[model samples]
Target: MAKHCTIIQGGMGVGVSNWKLAQTVSKAGQLGVVSGTALDQILARRLQDGDQGGHMRRALEAFPFPVMAERILKTYFVSGGKPAGTPYKTIPLLAKDNPRELAELCIASNFAEVFLAREGHCNAVGINYLEKIQAALLPCIYGAMLAGVEYILMGAGIPLKIPGVLDLFAEHRRAEYGMHVVGALEGDNTTMHFNPADFTECKLGSLTRPKFLAIVSSNTLATTMVKKASGRVDGLIIEMRTAGGHNAPPRGKLQLTDAGEPIYGERDDIDIAKLRELGIPFWLAGGYGHPEKLREALSLGATGVQVGTAFEFASESGLREDYKRDLLQKVISGTAHVFTDPLASPTGFPFKVAQLEGTYSEPELYAARPRICNLGFLREAYRTSEGDIGYRCPAEPTTVYASKGGNAEDVVGRKCICNGLLANVGFPQVLNGQRVELGIVTAGDDLVSIAQFLPPGQSYYSALDVIAALEKGCSVLST
Candidate 1:
């Protein structure tokens, strides 16, 4: 017999669903997930920031590969911290043929995040990744597996090949993921490969193949994943239009409401009964932050619920204090509004945004920031005229994005989500006149629902509070 839960703390990326938050939930006997997206860069930045609270140092010490840990520490660790106003050094952008250092960083960084989250907890922990961020997949998965991560939850794109990659690493073999290069002809080489032998000096350690859960929005994609995936997909997470982070685009031609939000109609509704016919475990997301919702999911035959907005504002989460405070106040007042912005993300998926002042979601704030593309995480790789590959992001400068085939109109109100997201977790970069560029914050449509997690008269709630609220009624499903 094995343990399962009726609630999963959804993986919020760019350090929002951090180790401490995840650990808190997992310790309370529910599935806790650490966001594995952009962790390599986040880890490097943390090291440069003097390894705050010595937590990174502890995780690095626990890393199985001592030499790899040593190499990363020697390269990125600053004794005190980088001076104020001096930007953290950016690592080279990940390409099909990555530099060895970048590859190592990906592995070590992913390992550290999961390792820290699982520390002192025998309960299972999970890692989440967006399939669109393909560059770091192999090493990132490898590192999480190395850290004994119990589950891997992925969404934002159909990940047809990830299960095979997990199997390869579990067997201590090399894993190769095909990169989706824009404008590449049928015969063009676009596969990225990672061999543990190349990086590990000794024989590779045996790794466990974690449970694979594909996040999906509809029954059609769920069926496709079950029937067409390269390997075993353990489960599915059914995220509705209301979930936080990126969302699946509406089917057919995109239509907008008078308020500018993407219109989700009858076709967008998921057929849960059809989902059950697939014979796989599934969790319901989006507005599923309440205990009543958990019961509804169970009654409907779901294994559990995956929640984001509530846990996101918990005290232990990595969201910055000012933003969290403002948002929490709104939640308490039942006035927080989340709009499904269709143009904010480079991936072109409908991104959920909290309407906060001074954030990139605000028109004035967005207009004030100059267009730049330093992060490049969201840059798309395309085959150049000479058969070389080039990367570009629609959120970059208008002239540059246009030259790369992006339509100026399509990018009109688009904000650079990469930098903004990084800023959300307190690493906002300072530009001219000490103006900190703000990243738009994304949360589930149940923004006001977070208030339920807080006790009456309590101004703040802990991750435990969220878990308790979610687990109140069903004892058997609590763990």
Candidate 2:
């Protein structure tokens, strides 16, 4: 039997949970997960920044396909990084019918990250992906598998087909994911296909199928996944509304609080009793970062808990030093606050925004920024009048979004999450060589409590510090 991991480090924003953080947590004997979101773009930007520390180049040298690895290095790696104020070159946005170059980038980039994270440790590592980003899903999974990823966790949608894709990919066979296209007629083709053989230079043995853990918010979703998922669902992470990043919208009619946040009622709560009846290992998320909460989870039949906010500010995470410094200061002063903004995400899901000045969370800063959708990670696919799939984002220019059949109201209050998240990790794109993108910070409600991990007289904490604290919590209660 596989040993249970008592704690799973949360895979956070953009590059925030990059290889370094994940590797640190995994080295501490817990399951560490790297954020699989926008990894291709992150890898490209890292190379363009001169592959600092020679880490990207090191990982690429170990990639199975030398030709593919060489192509990526040649295309993106700069001699000493791009000049300050110069815009980072953009990769093509993903689509149902993606070009070969984009697919190769996804595969190679994912491979490099997982490869690097798995280095210097024999412990298992995981990768987290948002199911909504379907276009790049196949190649990304294939790349991670090439680096021997042990777990694949997904949330943000009904991921019924992901398990089956894992099965096919393990045998090095072709895999396809059905793209969800809005306003599609009965016969529209919305399937994305990828084959490992097409991208490989030589024959290879079959790979192991990584265990799949679907992140769910309700008993209904969990039950549906266990009973109807195309293949075996190894486990689940039950995330509450208080968790960081994109939250599952509240159940039933959308009601807002007086403060403009979504009102999550009793119905929004997941029934732990029902989840226990499913006979699978499950973890509790959201506000379970404390020792008492970890103890409570174990007593309630949970396999473990996944923590985000605490690890997010850890010294090894990819979060920018200035932002981390400011947030930690707020945590110390009790001035830290998180707002669950209902209209900020283009996905229309509620996103938690940590109150930080000079970020997009500020009303004045948000309004001053121009609406551009060049990154296009969050664009929704819709059937055009020509019966072809066209992409649109509410965060795009108002007139441009409207011309693509998007509602004017939908565009209201929508912020460009793609750009904001990238900027949070210090890779913001420079538009027209002058307008630099600003970042928006996201953290769970537990952001205020992360001070417990800080050493006496120290402003920052490490992943080992977090693991020791949570493990001590579990140990104290177990004794």
Evaluate model 1: give its lDDT: 0.87
How far residue 304's Cα lies from its native spot in candidate 1, in Å, is: 0.6
Question: The CA-based lDDT of model 2 is what?
Answer: 0.93
Per-residue lDDT of candidate 2, residues 226-280 (tens digit)? 9999999999999999899999898899999899999989988889999999999
lDDT by residue for model 1 (72-143), tens = 999889978877776777788877888888888888888888988898879999999988888988988988
With a 3 Å backbone cut-off (N, CA, C), the pairs that clash in candidate 1 are 420-439
> What lDDT is reached at residue 210 by model 1?
94
lDDT of each: 0.87, 0.93
Assess candidate 1 and give its TM-score to the true structure: 0.97
Q: Residue 437 of model 1: what lDDT?
A: 67
Residue ranges of candidate 1 with Cα displaced over 4 Å: 432-435, 473-479
